[model samples]
Target chain A: MPRVDVELPSVLTGLLGVPRVVPVEASCLADALRELSELHPTIDVHLFDETGGFREHVLCFHNETNTRWLDGTDVALADGDRITIMQAVSGG
Target chain B: MGTTAVIGTAKGGFILRSDDRRTWSVEGPLFKGWKLTTTSRTPAGTYLAATASDVYGTAVHRSRDLAEWEQVETGPAWPAAAEGGGNGEARKLKQIWTFGHGGNRTYAGVDDAGLFASDDDGVSWTPVDGLNEHSTRSGWFPGAGGLCAHAVLVDPADPKRLWCGISAVGVFRSDDGGASWTPKNEGIPIVIEDKSCKDIGRCVHGMVADPKDANTIYRREHVGVFRTRDGGEHWERIEHGLPSWFGFPIVMDVPTNTLFLAPLESDEYRMPVDGRLSVYRSRDGGDSWEDASAGLPAEHAYVGVLRGAMAADQDGGVYLGTTGGQVYVSSDGADSWQTLPVTLPRVLSVEVYPS
Candidate 1:
């Protein structure tokens, strides 16, 4: 079982009203999100597009660097790997 | 984990959320009718809320527990009508866009005029008479938004020296604590083609002063994002790694000086590259930038982040509310992000309470 650690965004933590960090089994980064989507259904709606591609403002990182700059969406994951999902927000 | 507060405004009033980086319980729709513009906590356990409504003039509300709210009407109130009370007509009362607290006084940037100051915790007010006395107000004009003061930076180390960014006016600095003001636009680029950009302040969308080093400041102008090392004396544009040079809302990690910006796609009015959402970050100030839009939607889409919709936490966490009624969160700095459940009619502002 590939161990995956989920880190909830600060904005989500406040909305859900709790700290969320769960371990799941997945072979790739996309699989991990699919598994967690079962727990937070709303997130999945904004994460994936009509063609099932990631949104433009939405960014994914395996560790600290962007996954797009690495292996695109085919990036594989190993046990104890971490993933983060964030979107762009701007205001003056 | 420390306490962080998130205040957002909508159709009815304001909502307050207190969290400890992990959990948060809703505290309010604190005030009614007024869309809360800004909230800043005072050292004496007091909180100030700047609000504006369609029916009433803009006013500052005060609170103690973040629950109960009271409108402060004694001090320099908004201009009254012929019979007294706020302008009885439509959209007449001024709007308070942003505010800052320094020493024992809290200053507010009221739309249509200059700044307002309060000494007794939002109880009373007096216009910073110097703004009228200043020789620069006449030269300062309104931008995309009507005449509005959207950003105010107060040097924590030196209360007397301060800077404010207005919509169309660019940036102004007052080193003698509002006694006088000057236009500081030396290296800032201007939109005009004939005159010198030095005399006029560049059109600024958002700005943040490093809490750790007051001398360092980052700003997002109508053209690009620029930083000043020796305060506003000089500036350098830094938009090499961003998707588009046009953007609003710039936030900094209070203790770390890390900067975050949300850029909109260029070549279009208010559209993203591909229906995507991307938030960029600069860890070492604005020296460099890295995109943190993983798990976000695609580009070439129509979604614009408005002013006052982005905020950050002391834990390196960032939050943003969009015009599409969506809120996104990033816990591990700006490395990765995810969507949140809270949706609003139209998110005017998003803030994270410090822990």
Candidate 2:
């Protein structure tokens, strides 16, 4: 398993008190997200809908590139990579 | 030693504390950027709030002290198999509008207009199929606000007997513990006025059930204020002395047997009458009303109160917040008022727990 760092959005940490940066060991983004959910179970609902899909305002970045633009969350990952979770640009 | 209020707003939520209802201290703008939609204190003493944003969608948070909050993993949601396959045109759990607790059961009335029950004190939820899938559901629509089941009232004497208020869809009564439901809009006016489906189309802004008698229920509707003594079987207009018929946020102070409501000028503008905000109180049910905004602004206060923005604490203190982000309280049972000395984004809901 690769040890990756996940940077959470302030929108989540401000509400749930979860750390902004979480280090988890996983080989793929899918496993990393599962680990994140396991570590901070509360953030799961804020990140994904009940149907297990990303919430409307949630966006994921593998280092600098958006994970959404990648083939899928199952793509392999190496140790020391950074994953950024963010809220989409939403305002009237 | 005093009261702690959870004030929910469009931008965030605030926890206001006052040793005396006179002098106050404040906490939060917490839940920082999330739109705090509704707040509730369960009978078991858990503080709960629902938040929504264009980014992360809607989620429920629970707290013991209103300081640290936890988001519930399984809040109210429409199953992909039963309705819209995740935000479908017909059904989507847009927001949790209100929470009603009866015994160990906590019910959440939500947008997309559905009822969900939490047996373990808001930890998880299960949809109430009877009311959510009513036969006339196909005709259920939204008012100026979105389609939402915003109010749920449980009979104090009989928890099984419940009433739910859904915007643009009339009131519903469940006599068999939510196993079945029936429309109870006898004399209430309709918003969309769809004659084909007589049971729906009522835009009920807010509602309160008499603590003394579960049979009596009062609702501030789109057109006017109404009261029903026969448990929603029949209703009558209670606007005898009220300046206008339209309003939101109806609450009852059980100890004083008083009803408090904030009436806007009309549905067209949705602001105070002549830029003056007033909270009306009805002492004898809803026969007549009197202005209770003596200490509030006299004029130039063009504000509106949302449906869940007014609440009554256990000690009979009445609290209300406004679209202008002002919160007022009357310890003497709505006879007078005083501003809390703090303001924020448009106030959406206010819930107080006395210590």
Best by lDDT: 2
lDDT of 2 at B97: 93
TM-score of chain B of each: 0.88, 0.96
Q: Write the per-residue lDDT of candidate 2 for residues B195-222, one digit (tens) a residue.
A: 4777678888899999789999999898
Interface RMSD of 1: 18.0
True contacts kept of each: 0.00, 0.71
In candidate 1, what fraction of native interface contacts survive? 0.00
Docking verdict class for candidate 1: incorrect
TM-score of each: 0.72, 0.94
Query: Model 2: which residue pairs collide?
Result: A57-B55
C-alpha-based local distance difference test score of model 2: 0.86
Provide the lDDT at B207 for model 2: 91
